[model samples]
Structures are given as structure tokens and as C-alpha cells.
Target: MQILANIIPYFISQVENFSRRERISFAYLSIENVLGFSKSDCILKNDFKINKKDIKSLINIVNQLKKNVPIQYIFEETIFYNLKFKLNKSTLIPRNETEELVKWVLQYKFNSLFDIGTGSGCIPISIAKNSNSIISALDISLDALEIAKINAMYHNVKVDFICDDIFSYIPKRKYDIIISNPPYVLKSEKVFMSKHVLDHEPHSALFVDDSNPIIFYERIIKLSSDYLNDNGMLFFEINEKYSGDIIKILSKYNFVDIELKKDINDRDRMIKAVMK
Candidate 1:
């Protein structure tokens, strides 16, 4: 509808923290999702009438946005690595940094792989779709695993999903690769986070104790040698502040060929090591 263009301006006015451009972008995307209209359709049919039901849905979403709800949750789905993933409060939403991790893993060869903390199973599912490797994904949250299972099915890929704490789970067979985008944000950093993330996203999947930020990394590295075949690769999405510290931890565990990589933003966001 011609009036729909006003939706962009209205959201921009209501969202104080986000830039005007960003608010408009969110509104455009939300409208597209609600109306099932392509960019071309929206441009060519500016005068198209919006159904009352669709208008109501759009209004509700915009109201939620005004309250700082994440747009991803507003839609309950998001596109990650060119795949649609169902999202809920139980899991961390897929991010661009995680997409880069998937791309890096796909470039390498592996006989079998395990994804630790596989929220939404995006990393594992994307890798499985591209490679012939047998993949298993682990997450502690059953709700998150449920969404992951649905995503795996939607992508027509079979991934073994397990509900087990990464710290306690022991693998019977050694894997050629282990990948994880684990929770690394420190509790103190909560103050700096947006309300959308702090309030809507699962805190268990997003944070670590500030006193021991590397607890998960320490455990992952300690057990990696047992579960990874010799020369097996360990990949992680790490906190930028502790890239050097994590590399040091891996070195202490005798993980060789350790490498740290930057994300598209040029932040140190990933680390890789080969088990000796």
C-alpha cells in the first residue's frame, strides 16, 4: 500500500538508539516478510493494497520494535549463511561472525566433524550441505536442539544432534575436526549490550563468568586431545579481547599450528589449532 512507505518513517522516528537508516532497513525487511513481497514487487506496485490482517501484523511488529525487541525474534526466523533458521529465546541467533567460521571450516577437508554448542545448528548444517563429512552437533539446550533438528531437516541434511554439556560429553570416536562458537561474552560486558540481546536472547548461551572467561576454552582444549585424532583441527569463535590469551592456552595444551583469524570487521574473532 502507498501508506506502507510511511511505516519506514514511523519506525525511524520511534527507534532512538538505531540510526534512521537502520530503522528504515528493519522496517523494510519486516514489511517484506509480512507481505511476502519481493523488492521488485514493492517497487513496481507501490499502490498495492495491504490486507487488514497483514497491516495488523505489521503494526504489532513495529510496536515490539519500539520496545527494543530484536527484529529476529519479531519474525521468529532469520537468514543465516543463505539458509532460513527458526529462532527462539532458547538459543543464540546466528551471526555473521559464525558464518565466517562456517566458511573457514568448509575450506578444509575432514572425514568427520563435531560442532560444540551448536545453537540453531547453522554452522553444522551449512557445512553438511556443502561437504560429504559425517557431522554431529552438541548443545545443552533441548529447545535449541529442537530448532536445530528442524533446520537440519529443512536443509535435507542429516546431522546427529545431542543434548549434552560440552564440558561433560565424551566422544567414543575421534573426530578430524571440532568447531564451536561458544559463549564467551563476559558477565561484566552485559552493561554494554543492547537491550534486545540482554532481555530477549538466552543469557546462558551468550555469557561467561567474568572471573574465568576462558573456562569453556580450557575444558575444550583439555579434552580435545583425547577426542581429536592426531593432527585434528580445533576451531573456535573467540572473544576478541582474549585472542592472545586463548592462543596461549592452546599452546600450553600442546596444540600446534595455532592460528588466529579476523572477521570481516577485522576483529580477532576465530582461532584454529591442530592437536599434536
Candidate 2:
């Protein structure tokens, strides 16, 4: 049997290539994942005994962390907007900025909504759990849509999961809101990203061509004209570097009431506009 207190230090020592803060955070999360122990429980129950099997699991988690695999993927699940969702390499892990975009989406009421490039169905499922909107989500990858469908079922939320590339998709009906946290990272921006993200997360869900970094945004904006109801709202989780360019695209498409909002990090990471 291993005491919780002793395990933490050992876990920390085994994990590398991360900052001091990250090591501590991962250690706590590893404990929680392996033992169902909270952060406070680690200290309060420092004498908590871990059996051999759990100890092995914790060690495996630490080894994965050392290799820069995200903790969420290790656990195969993550909590977003207070809802638990399954995850895998098939989907990009939901981001805080995307949560902010969902918050902006939840601020208004709409009947029918559609999400473009829904990876794990985090956005629409969270909104569906909170609102009565009829939500439909689209993704090109069947693997991603499979995970998304499972998440919707687990959450007991109804979302029409469509497996289709957004560029070729023709909306069968208009929606009161169309939202997306689509691929906005340019291929050139790969150097600035973390090793864990570049190495683990799905590339097609993350990157756009440097030649047309705003391709997803532009296609969604153009489609919004046909897919959105009169005066319908449109929302996007944007790349901070190209917020101005996205606004210009929206304007060129004749969208009005364009609003750009920052994430918790104060980066220009979200944009909302109205269909005129």
C-alpha cells in the first residue's frame, strides 16, 4: 500500500518537461483520476492508502503526462460547462475560449441553432442542456461524430449529429443561431503552439492553411446568409490574430451588429454578429 502523501512526490518526480506549477497540477489531477480523491483530500487524507493496481494506474498516467499527453485524453473524458463529455484524438479538446463563446450563445434565446465543425459536441450539448433550443451539429469525421453522439446521449441532450464536411453541407432549414469554434489556427502558427497540442490533438480540427487561415470562418459566414433566419445571430470562437479580418469577412457578407469579445485571457477570441 502506498500513502497518498508519498505518492504525490513520486508522481511529481516521474513527470518531466512541464513547469513546476503544471507538475503539481498534474500530480493532483492524477491522484483524483486514480483514486477519486479531491485536492483537499490529498492533504486531509495524506495517509490514504493506495492499492497496487491504483498505484500502477497512477504511474501510467504520470508516464503519459511526461510524454505531453493531455490529462483529459488520459482520463478519456473532461468536464465542460459543468457537463461531462467523452474525448479522444478524434476531437480537439474543448477550450476555455469556446466556453466563453457558449456563454455568449446562452445569453440569448433561440429556437433552432446549428454548430459548424462540432468536434465533441461540447458547445451544442452544453447549450441544449441549458436551453430548449433544437440543436444540430456537423463534423466531417465519423469518429468525431461518434464521440459527439455518445456525449449527447450521456448528457441526455438531443443534438442532431451530422457527419459531413461543412464546405459542401447544404442546410435543409434556417436556424435562429449558427455558431462554430472551427479551425482557425494557421499552419504557420504551429511553432507557437504547445507540443502536447500539436502532437496529440486532431490536426484537421485545429489548423487552416496559412494561405487562407480564415477559410472556415469565411465559408461559415457565407453559408450563414442562407442558413440563418431573418435577424438571426451568428457566433464564432476566433483566432485573436485574425479578429479584424474575421470582422471584415462578416461585413462583406452584410452581417450587422458585429461584436468582438475577449476570452478570460483578454485575447480577442470570440465574435458575434447578427444576420441583417
User: Which candidate number would show the highest TM-score if scored against the true structure?
Assistant: 2
Worst 10 residues of 1 by lDDT: 1-10
TM-score, predicted candidate 1 vs. hidden true structure: 0.95
Instruction: Find the number of clashing residue pairs for candidate 1.
Output: 0
TM-scores for all candidates: the values are: 0.95, 0.96
Q: Write the per-residue lDDT of candidate 1 for residues 20-55, one digit (tens) a residue.
A: 877878878877888876666766766677778887
Top candidate, metric lDDT: 2
lDDT per model, in order? 0.87, 0.90
lDDT of 2 by residue, 1-276 (tens): 289998767866777688778888888888887799999998899998889999889888888988999989999899899889999999899987888889899999899999999999999999999999889999999999999999999989999999998989999899999999998888898999999999999999999999998899989999998889999999998888898899998999899999999878878889999997
Model 2 stretches with alpha carbons more than 4 Å out: none
lDDT score for residue 75 of model 2: 91
For model 1, state the Cα shift of residue 30 in Å: 1.9
